[model samples]
Target: MADITAAMVKDLREKSGAGMMDCKKALNETAGDMDAAMDWLRTKGLAAAAKKSSRTAAEGLVGVAVSGTKGAAVEVNSETDFVAKNDQFQQFVRDVTQVALDGAGDVDAIKAATLPNGKTAEDTLTTNVATIGENQSIRRVKRLEVSQGAVVAYVHNQQSAGLGKIGVLVALESAASNDALQALGKQLAMHIAAAFPMALNEEDLDADLIERERAIAAEKAGESGKPADIVAKMVDGAIAKYRKEHALVSQLFVMDGKTKISDVVAKAGKDAGAEIKLVDYVRFQLGEGIEKEASDFAAEVAAASGVPQQPAPVN
Candidate 1:
């Protein structure tokens, strides 16, 4: 076995168009022989897979899997929706999501977890990218579980049975019957998909987000020409409202639009003759935060045709 240096691996990745891990493995497999490494990558088809790795992949599916008291959600992105519909790509999302439900709680863990095909998730992903002829990536994974009750999974705008545009999991802890838990969990999951709560509770909201809201509120209050005490009160009120509107428990239930989620859970528990708690939740909207690049199609066509620029008439 040879000691594979970073520079050597970088060289192999450049020449072979393979991922960093694959390049390093190739170098190690061939005792640092660059040509042998290239052959190794080519044999596995890893070299061709990553040639398009630089392309932006913002379209794909969010897959969900649930078992007993646990559930998992995963987002696998592809450069185009056409590729997303590929059978292989959908299977990858399904397999990786099951891995997440089995305890791979994070992106790295899911990638490292082995698939039924005897390939690690990363290897499977690379192989898919090669066969699919598009850049693809496992964007994220989120798992939720409860101690005593149920973890329910839901998908909206589904492309397949459990893969879709929006994936949600709702964890409910209770001694209630499975039927009751399922019903409550489904409604809550549906609410989560539509409402898009930021956190399970107000205190769970991101500190930076809260601070940014506070700053915005303070600036608005400052423009009010009110007394310092009144301005401070206004800022506080704004922050409080923001937190309530964004936190899951404090948010008004989307079902009827009047009941807070906390109250909804309480009523459901009362009807079930037990104490039911909303334990945790995850909502993954595919490509939610990705900034997609916009291309000028007409400009690209003109450039391809080698045509001169034309000015538009004044409106």
Candidate 2:
């Protein structure tokens, strides 16, 4: 049997948010394998989701660049937010984002593209990491283009001109004037940032997410002790509400908080004397879906002193 080391236990504990002893036990059960230990903790409901372990809980900037009808957004992550403020780091993010605008939205392709300094983006990033004294990475890249109309970009809480915590792109496909299309697109991009819609429509939402919601609704409805038909209707109602709340077009516009987004676009198009279609959108919230390690000073002290840590009291 492989011996479980204290460092392994601590690492698993941080990744899974499980108790120290639980992590040690899982490691032992899994023969000191980190991945298997994580799975073991999850199967026992002692750990958070597996994706928590893979979360890029780093700090950096999400940079955006737009060239005429095409726009690109990229997330360049650094070990610390301080590094994000570095001029060198910011410049690298901006350059990479522009590189992504021309390349396919694939990270590998973008990384392989040539930079203005006559170096591959990947090589430049490596040089930056060595020079900046912090590990950094190009996490993701996305591009949006419209055959006509406008593809608008917006940065929320921008730290720099085109870099920020949240970057959004709205692709409007229409024959509308650029002025009108751009105005509507910017509003839509702002809405995307505020609303955080999951998809353009209900049909576009993830099937697994819909199923998970349905299971939760069914379980809640089953506990109500109503007739099966009534319970079924309750579940359906819950799903419908969930779908509307998550879908971009069905969500209420953030500006008015009353008008639906689809209606807003329709009204904007009518006023502009052109038919506008919101083809797609992308919103990248920095460090989103990345679970940061919880800082529990008391728990840390207790663990270090080999004392059992007690759960916090309910408020």
Candidate 3:
């Protein structure tokens, strides 16, 4: 067996983006063969899934596709909105969205899945980057399915027919007629796109996020100079309100702005004569969590406002 050296371990770590120990183990598993070790790391998902040219955060399109009880949403990001509006880029997003709907399930899986052009999705993206002279990557993908109901899709700030800044998929499970389910799902999807609930339910909310909110609430309540017990009660109340306001079912429907989403679904169920459950949803807002480079931001500002490079948008 070939001996693994620190230089080999460091090199593998840089190449695979895996932990030092993992890289060393991969090298050992492949008998210190770098190419084989890289493949080993990828097979274990320790390497980057996409062959990205750069890590700079940039603009892109969110694409949504639907078929009966299943729907898929994907975000394909590029170096600029100009590239996002490219015909080739849009077609690539559409193709990847369809691949996700066909059960690609996640970004890694979709990147490995074959496109109609007989190339893997990642290869197609690499080719697009080279041909279009802009770096791009398949940022993310989400798929939703319902057992006996409909999954509805909505695109906000559309760049094309199915490509947009925000893509939402709502899954409604029921035995009601498909027509009724479709109508309800569309309305709910619109509401989801607008309200931006953090989770499907109070129980589904992230614990860390909840704790962060609680900390902020406590600090604000402490400023009221109340007794310890009163302050504790106030914090609890604040947390309860936060949970309600940030959960999909508990949020007031955007249309009426008074009735809770849970109530809206129940009323719709009554109208359709079946029990309906809002099961799950996926919302992809373009470039939401990406870390943007200042240079990229300046260029985006220039492109968007038709002015020379300026500071990024305040919001």
Q: Which candidate wins on TM-score?
A: 1
Candidate 2 TM-score versus the reference: 0.78
Model 3, position 110, has a per-residue lDDT of: 96
Q: What C-alpha lDDT do the candidate models reach, one value each?
A: 0.86, 0.87, 0.86
Question: CA lDDT of 262 in candidate 3?
Answer: 94
Clashes of each: 0, 0, 0
Q: Name the candidate that leads on lDDT.
A: 2
Clashes of 1: 0
In terms of lDDT, the poorest run of 10 residues in model 1 is: 48-57
Candidates ranked, most accurate by TM-score first: 1, 2, 3
Candidate 3 lDDT tens digits, 128-190: 989999989898888899888889888988888989988999999999989998899889989
**Which residue runs does candidate 1 get wrong by more than 4 Å?**
1-57, 300-314
- Candidate 2: deviation at residue 83, Å? 0.6
Clashing pairs in 3: none
Which RMSD values do the candidates have, in order? 16.4, 7.4, 14.4
